[model samples]
Target chain A: MTGGSELPIASNADVVLVRQQVRSAALEVGLSLVDQTKVVTAASELARNALVYGGGGMARVEIVENGPRKGLKLVFSDEGPGIADVEQALTDGWTTGGGLGLGLSGSRRLVDEFDLVSAPSKGTTVTVTKWAR
Target chain B: MERVPILKLGDILIISIQIDLEDQSVLALQEDLAEAVVAHSARGVIIDITAVEIVDSFIGRMLATIAAMSRMLDAQTVVVGMRPAVAITLVELGLSLGGVRTALNLEKGVALLDHVRGATP
Candidate 1:
């Protein structure tokens, strides 16, 4: 198994850039375009969530092996206002701003596995994984 | 963002969306789409999203809402030119754009609308 890498995203504009990096990293790990697109989309949503809701954060992209399968994992963490109601925030159409509130919820649907950790005032972290199949 | 109306073919309206479909810019497109569908009594509408690179959940939800609204106005809406990456993202975000049609490209989208209109009449 090969080692993984981490990319930091600090600004809103960097979200898109980080997505590209994630795509490249996924490809470097031998993911096809279809799989690459999936990872990129996941990265973009998580990165955007970090920027919009978390007031900016960083994304960590890494490759890992899971018992006969290899996959990519993206972890997005932010030090902004943590979610007050994590469940409500995950619900569709629930939003604090004019947005459609699809960021976190939608991102969960695209990846093979998803996990989130957040609090009211501490911060938020989202981790997603896509397996090579 | 510039809004360019491609043409009015029959009762269907085809418009080219020349802007990044982001959280901030989707609102204008939504309003304009509503107005155009109502004013023209369009039976179908095609939106070109080739210029858009990424689509977050906010924009996806807005597009879904717009499609629903268009249906209420008696018009069917189709989103065209979704990059593979965008489609993957939308699906991952758990957004099911029910009732909204999608095509690989604008030309194909127009052709689909034509077929739909023809089948109806």
Candidate 2:
């Protein structure tokens, strides 16, 4: 991680702040316009999930490098009640919160890499990365 | 909480979202638009998002919801000025925004509304 920042997700306003922070990081990492939008949008979803589902958490934005390639990595973690089934949670149109249920699944499609970890009582953390091409 | 202003232009209401919208702002915009449509007796609503940098699921749902609400109020909603990148991201995000009409820009959006309303009555 070269240039990194951490943002707290405690309210709807924080989610917007997360998006702005991620957008700047993506731009700094030289992501194209579309890629920048994808990553920022993903950050928005994950940040909101941390606030709404996780009952507030934190977001870490980092500029990562893989050899000559550079990328943006975002990690969102929360201490709220965790998901019992990761597969069902990742499945599209499956929501426990009456939302569109696309936050997890849709965000996965927007990035190059996705990792989700959670347990019924262990809380949840989602990390996603988008590489510049 | 930023309140998105709704401008009444004839029988149409124009809402240009120029800020990074929080969830509350999105919800408030929905309510404001609904009221504007009824109050103005609007036949069409144009939502301009040219300056918006991103449209996540929440914002996407808001657009769809506003369109649905406007329809029920006898007004057509046309979302215009979506950046190309935003459009691509929206499709990949699985938010097809079905039932919500779109145009390339505000001019086309206004033209579309005129055509739809003219053809209907």
Candidate 3:
């Protein structure tokens, strides 16, 4: 496993930058075109959520070699007012922000692994991984 | 702070997206597009995004919002030249974009928009 880079999520421009960076990382993992698109889209949604809802945050990209089954992992962390109920957050059609509410649940469905931890008024961290297939 | 130029031609507004669209830029474009539609008394709009290789859900929403807004103003919108990858990604991200009409290129999109208005130009 190799650690990747960190991207600041302070502004809208950073969102696009991180999306492209994640796409490049996913490409290095040799993800299929569809897989690359999925993870890239997922990255965009998560990064936007981190910036829009979390006030601001950071995104980390990592490359994993799990017994030769290579994959990429994305982590988004924010110090904003965290979600009180993660399960409720993951449910489609629910949003604390003025968005379409598909950012959370939709990203979950795009990748292979999903994990989230958050605390009210503290912060939220979302980790997702997509194995190359 | 990048600006999207909106050109008017015979009651039609055309926006050709040539740069990587930042969120702020897109939002600005949305606002400007709304204003242009009214200012020009445009009957239709055509957005050419052939240069955009990637589109997120937010961008997708922006497109849909533009289409919806144009429709509300009694003007039709046609999004043209969406790369295949972007379309695939949008579908996978669960955005049907049914509210907006799509065409393969700018010519087709203009034709469709003009057809809607019964305009020869």
Candidate 4:
């Protein structure tokens, strides 16, 4: 299994490049196109959130084997203002801005496993995983 | 992607969304939908999402926004043909697509729009 990391670019447009890199990495690690798309979408959302909400962050993509199955993991970390209310933030329809508030919650639903860690005035980290079927 | 025609049947304007309604695509269509509603003075708008496999929050919010905007223009909006998996995911994500009407199929959506327009007229 290979581990890779991408530094967050200050521009929102860089999120697309980051998404492509993560998708390519997922393919290199043997994920199917459908699975690759899902992982890529989740990564894109997180990366966009990092740029748009977190002020900027890095995304780390890693491949791991769990027994007989192999899976891809993406970790997005940012050093911006963390979520104040994690639960409310996860709730659908609740948004700090005019956004649809689907970024974190929707991305979580797209993956097999999702985890988030954030603190006020500190930073936030989001991890998402998808296993090959 | 094939561009589906904006079909008009009486007072209803049916626009088939042929791709994933996410990111900039959704944003672009918001203007188009508004224009369609105004140009035709449509009584109802049916947005077909059968080809879409995913519905992110951004798109969901756009749908809600479009629905609200359509209503303000005297047109009702109905979202149709959402896949079951996609529907479940949207629900799980807690996406509140409030104010947007939904139907299981395009035929049903058109029928519902007909009924809505009939009642209003």
lDDT of 2 by residue, A1-133 (tens): 6758888999998998899888888889999999999999999999999999999999999999999999999999999999999999999999999899999999999999999999987889999999999
Interface RMSD of each: 3.2, 0.4, 1.5, 4.0
i-RMSD of model 2 (Å, 1 decimal) = 0.4
DockQ of 1: 0.36
Best of the candidates, lDDT = 2
Residues B7-115 of candidate 1 have per-residue lDDT tens digits of 5777887766665334444666678778878787888888777876666665677668877998899887889998776776666566767767899887888788788
Q: Summarize candidate 4's per-residue lDDT along B1-121 as a digit string, tens digits.
A: 2234578878788878774333555677788778888898888888888886556566677789889999999998999998775666666566657688999998999889888878888
TM-score for each of the candidates: 0.69, 0.99, 0.92, 0.74
Residues B14-106 of candidate 2 have per-residue lDDT tens digits of 999998899999999999888888888999999999999999999999999999999999999999999999999999999999999999999
Q: Which one is best on DockQ?
A: 2
Docking class of 1: acceptable
Per-candidate total of colliding backbone pairs = 4, 0, 0, 1
Model 3, position B108, has a per-residue lDDT of 97
Global lDDT of model 1: 0.76
Question: How high is the lDDT of residue A95 in model 4?
Answer: 77
For each candidate, what is the lDDT?
0.76, 0.94, 0.89, 0.77
Please report, as a residue range, the 10-residue window in candidate 3 chain A with the lowest summed lDDT: A92-101
Candidate 3 structure quality by residue, lDDT tens digits, A28-62: 99998888888988988999999998999999999
Candidate 2 docking class: high
- How do the candidates rank by DockQ, highest first? 2, 3, 1, 4
How many Å off is the CA of B96 in candidate 1?
Answer: 2.1
Error of 4 at A122 (Å): 5.1
